[model samples]
Target: SIKLVLKMLDRQMAVIDKNIDGMLKEHFAEKLALFKDFKGVGPCMQAALMGALPELGQLTHAQIGKLVGVAPLNADSGRHKGKRITWGGRATVRTTLYMAALSAIRYNPVIKTFYERLLANGKLKKVALVACMHKMLTIMNAIVKSGIPWNPEHQNVSKNA
Candidate 1:
């Protein structure tokens, strides 16, 4: 009976997921396509982004990062300099971005290389991951703003230049 109940719940969840996907495609097709263009960004991340950050394309990268609570803020006061830390803003968006970043670091070429470079440069693993999350967010923001799909070649050229 317990197993049957679990199976029923799983089927319900699958149906709900399918419905959400259909609704997102129907209502936010363009935005969903933009989000899905990025490597490792899937339907769930696209839905979360579209729902939580309706202003994604309208704001600057720094502004979006700050809004999502991923931007590092200065904690300095006169000569008493302090480490920059991220705080405040929408926790759900931040968490979603973090998950997206984790996947990106594994499968997205630019993200993976950038993450490795940061680690090689002696940055803490968590710090590097956060930086990757911020970078991914910025990339997505720019993509949405410019109406361009994710292009690793373009990103590489810009980085070199």
Candidate 2:
């Protein structure tokens, strides 16, 4: 059965669609097409990205991470463990990002290599997946904000990667 939350979101989108002015509608429709061209990115995920990062076209890497709740937070004390993962941001955004990460693992070489490396190190599946998602968000932020696309050969080399 369809969930009530999905039903509510559908109604909300209907109202918003009705209210968008003609020019903004046209503009978004056009840009949305461009977004759909990215591998594994669909309309729903693109919409989620735009909604989560409204200024996505303008955000820097760090700003984008915090917005999506993937940015690491300090969890250390005098003798505690490493940093803690953030857990209190937009849930829908994080879910969509998680899907993107899975797709990136299948189709994006750089991300795939990173994901394999995490797995090789014996990380739990979910933990490695979250790390992949964070990496995805960072790369997507740089691409969307800079009006560029993924270019493995041209990206700054990271030794840890």
> Which one wins on lDDT?
1
Q: Which lDDT tens digits does candidate 1 get at residues 1-161?
A: 99999999999999999999888889889866766557878877788888888998899999999999999999999999999999898888888888988999999998999999999999999999999989988888998899887777895688899
Model 1 lDDT at residue 147: 87
Which sections of candidate 1 miss by over 4 Å? Answer: 156-161
Q: Ten residues in a row with the worst lDDT in model 2?
A: 30-39
- Local accuracy by lDDT, each model: 0.88, 0.72
Root-mean-square deviation per candidate:
1.9, 5.7
Looking at model 2, the pairs that clash are none
